[model samples]
Target: MPAKKPFALRLDEKMMQAVEKWAADEFRSTNGQIEWLIHEALKKAGRLKDTKEGGRMKDEG
Candidate 1:
């Protein structure tokens, strides 16, 4: 595993609220949920290369 990198992500109020609710319902941190969404999208497009998951974890881990 590599060291986790940190950066700022700006979201509109409405979008942020939706993501927050979804994350809560799924018992995942907002960051984790977002990562999972991105990972799934990449997989659907055949862009993920990492065996461990290209840029995200498979679970809410």
Candidate 2:
């Protein structure tokens, strides 16, 4: 596992609401959904690293 970084995130009211709804729909915590969204965005930008424990790169497809 990689070292985790801590930082602050500021979301506008509407954006936060949308994320909350999406998180509920996906049965994931809001923080988890945010992490997933960040990971996905990074992957799309070719900035995400691959993991050995079955975590594949998004672009591998």
Q: Which candidate is the best by lDDT?
A: 2
| lDDT (Cα atoms) of all candidates against the true structure | 0.83, 0.84
Report the poorest 10 consecutive residues by lDDT, candidate 2.
Answer: 51-60
Q: Please, what are the lDDT tens digits per residue for candidate 2 over residues 1-61?
A: 5698888999999999999999999999999999889878987887866643567543455
User: lDDT by residue for model 1 over 1-61, one digit each (tens)?
Assistant: 7698888999999999999999999999999999888877887887866555666645324
Which candidate has the top score in TM-score? 1
TM-score (C-alpha) between model 1 and the true structure:
0.74
Candidate 2 yields a Cα-based lDDT of: 0.84
Q: Please state the error at residue 40 of candidate 2 in Å.
A: 0.6
Clashing pairs counted in every model: 0, 0
How displaced is residue 28 in candidate 2, in Å? 0.5
* Cα-based lDDT at residue 53, candidate 1: 62
